[model samples]
Target: MSSAAYERIRNNPKFDKLVATRSRFAWTLSAVVLILYYGFMAVVAFNPTLLASPLGEGRIATIGWPIAALMMLLFWVMTGLYVHRANGKFDEINAELIKEATKEAQ
Candidate 1:
């Protein structure tokens, strides 16, 4: 693409909003996942027994088992959410940006 095309997109307000919204959303998700993962790790580091200890008197499962499962589920959910939003809102803004840029180029 030409510099003019690039400039047109760069100057578009919707382009700025798209970048801002996508970046903020991505960073927020990253922060949440990091905090959850590291919070679990920190707990393990400080309290090893809490993770290893059985859930109850007769149960075979440990607390860590469910937590690990939840973490995996959280990762999947977050991924799905990001994909859904990107396919919807992000794509819409992107298409608008392209449409506007093409109009300007012509």
Candidate 2:
């Protein structure tokens, strides 16, 4: 594509909205993952015994095991959500913006 096409897309308000929306969403997801990871670390640092304890009266597993597993699962779910949005809403807006830019350039 020509620079003119790129310039038209950049000047479009929808382009701005798409960038803002996508950045906000990505940042939000990043923050959630950071919090989860750091919070777990904090607990492990300040209270080792809590996480080190057994899962139940007779179980060999520790409480931290399931928590760590769930955290990983949640991270995967968050990733999937981002991919879904990027492929669905973000891609749709991007395609529309490109189409508009191409038309204007012609």
Candidate 3:
């Protein structure tokens, strides 16, 4: 059987490279964020006092609000990072693929 879908996609080296790059980046970012967020939660869970104390207070600005704000900020930052990379790099790859496919079809 012919693998038209696979072949069509694989024929474009840039497409594969782009996909791999995006996948790697996404995985790495996810792991980092997951580790940081979950690690914080785990520490907090284990030692509630640590997160609630003045010195060991989870966040800088006021403990509770600060921690919440920090988490929101971090999540937004990650989202922005992903959007930037996807638009700058992945979109280029996608455009090239579409152009090539259209050309081939014509």
Best by lDDT: 2
Best by TM-score: 1
Which pairs of residues have clashing backbones in candidate 3?
none
What C-alpha lDDT values do all the predictions have? 0.92, 0.95, 0.77
The regions of model 3 sitting more than 4 angstroms off are: 1-6, 55-65
lDDT of 2 by residue, 42-106 (tens): 99999988998999998889999999999999999999999999999999999999999998766
Q: 1-106 in candidate 3: lDDT tens per residue?
A: 2455446767888877988999999999899889878888886788676566553446454365567578879978998999999999799888888777666655
RMSD per candidate (Å) reads 1.2, 1.3, 4.0
- State TM-scores per candidate: 0.92, 0.91, 0.77
Please give the range of 10 consecutive residues that has the lowest summed lDDT in model 3.
53-62
Which tens-of-lDDT digit does each residue in 5-38 have in candidate 1?
Answer: 8899999999999999999999999999999999
Clashing pairs in 2: none
- Candidate 2's displacement at residue 59, Å, is 3.0
Off by over 4 Å in 2: none
On TM-score, the stronger of 2 and 3 is 2
